[model samples]
Target: MKKIVLIIALLSPLFTYAQNKPNKKKGPTTYDLLIGTYTSGTSKGIAVYRFYAENGRLAYLSQIDGVTNPSYLTLSSNNKFIYAVNETPKGEVSSFSFEPKTGKISFINKQSSEGDDPCYVGVDKAQKNVFVANYSSGTVAVLPVNKDGSLSKAIQTLHDDGAHGPNKDRQEGPHAHMSILSPDEKYLLYNDLGTDKVNVLRYRASNEKPLEPASTPFVSVKPGDGPRHLEFSADKKHAYLITEMGSNVLVFDYDNGKLKQKQTITLLADNFKGQTAGAALHLSPDGRFLYASNRLETNEIIVYAVNQETGELTFVQRQPSMGKNPRDFAIDPTGKFMIVANQNSDTIYVLRIDNATGKLSPTGSRLEIGNPVCLKFAPAQ
Candidate 1:
């Protein structure tokens, strides 16, 4: 009996030690993904998903319906509200209160976009103003965001009238594609694809008519380049413009709301002659790399090594987007993965980004939704 008792006592400590061992498996770090889609098809409205940053996987969550073509989405600085553009003949901008914990959203109130077919939406850093680019109407409207996160009536509307681009079918008139706020929130810049120019305006929250033309009102690109999107470097010293018609990226030196052309690079191979359209442009969090996506023919992402000192770009590698017609894509806050919204393919592809070389590799995970047009990530609550 003594021998058996001694043996049991020795094993008890071992059993306790095994029971107290730390877990080797770690829980996933999650982020809230908001997808904007075209409502012409089966898609009702914005779809929400939970993205597992640890492994580049997404779990579908609930969605908010009844919105017509919430084609583009932007989140408030506080991450407590979301704003979307109702792309319709009679355009509208809707606001919603976002619950990150539950991945659910509740409709607040919507206001007229002051134009037709609004395509893009952006919120100021102060969260006091919301901006919409009316693509069909060739106007940009500034709407005040109420304290409760709803949108008030548009306070000011700026009409852009200019010479049309060379492409008569697509660029017959001013088509404002995107409206973005400068890093300091002191200026607003918008691209007019039809006019092939970027309009810069000074923004003041306290003023009655907040948006005024900047000293350098506009920067004109090549006649038919069709500047679609603009992305500023982390230092705010450089800007990159993605041209839809030409399928190229243009580099610019930015200073005090003025842009000077630096360089232009093609997004395709020298010998590959096919229809190409540049869609989206994004810079890595570290500002070491730049990524731009080409739709239609190529359906690939053009990677570039950014010269931090001079803001010049050197071609890196082009990787397939893994789906068709990548209209928009976003890099997660951690910069570990990129999610591409393939509008025509009805899918979203997850690609792992190599931090060392800025190259992309497929993670083999995809989300199926009807005509996913825009992707936005909010930190998990």
Candidate 2:
């Protein structure tokens, strides 16, 4: 019967279509890891690695040698260039052009940081300026970015004049520790470790000197808090600060260039008391959780459940860094693994991330490097 044949042909075509449709395309399985170090020990300079996403492993690729203390690093928005702080008494900033495909970097140029012991470096999205935080001199310098990805001399330097904190030894003078761009890239916030203040500055990418003090000059924390680093929420409505001396995470409601403290939480346990020093804090990729690293006696990653509505944090669980003095950690682009750098132990460890519970478990993967303090992840290209 012709009618029966037509039905069979239609059903056959439908079955073929269903069978030919390919399975869901998989995501990227590899990324590039950039490690910044103190460079005083075995590390030659900045090191690069190829990271396997599926199994959370790392393979060393190449490194730039003979550069002095490339301690803190920041990449341009396009990932085409990188800037690092020399972190010496006569501080300097170095520039390099990066090739995302081959994990190779070429030195471009270097410039004076305009102060002593520059510790942190940041670059604007448009590559117009590179900012440096000078710790010992307590100053912030803005250097113009050359068209060829090099750095020009600092155009502006602002000295921190805030009063010192109560700690006599550590807070003898102002010490600028870090400078971070806001989520929207509209403001620059830096912390003074010796002044106990988080200073916010308005940013304009096109200007020769791109930073200006915000309406609210600085937000004062407890005298001995020693704010070290600050991380803002993905939505730009909240901010979190970790103190180096006091070892507390402070929550704040962030608005147009202003911060209002809301809640403060301690990173140390009640019974275990030795020493406390908070280093770095970061919000998870999905913005559902916050992770902070505590150095000194407690070498652990403290997790917290972020309250989306109220911009507050509830304690999650603590995971050991599996090494000594965890300085900084980076979550892979896929958000499946965490890479932690142990400056004292000279080891880097990878941990598996639980998407559901905001917890971390050791992946048993480790890389041995000397004085690894910072870890950053980018696409392998």
lDDT of every model, 2 decimals: 0.93, 0.90
Off by over 4 Å in 2: 1-27
Native-referenced Cα lDDT, model 2: 0.90
All candidates' TM-scores? Answer: 0.92, 0.94
Query: Candidate 2 lDDT, tens digit per residue, 30-119?
Result: 888999999889998999999998889899888999878988998998989989999899999999999878899899999999999999
On TM-score, the leading prediction is 2
Residue-level lDDT tens digits of model 1 in 165-216? 8889999999999999888888999999999999999998999999999999
RMSD per prediction, one decimal?
6.1, 2.5
Query: What does the lDDT come to for candidate 1?
Result: 0.93
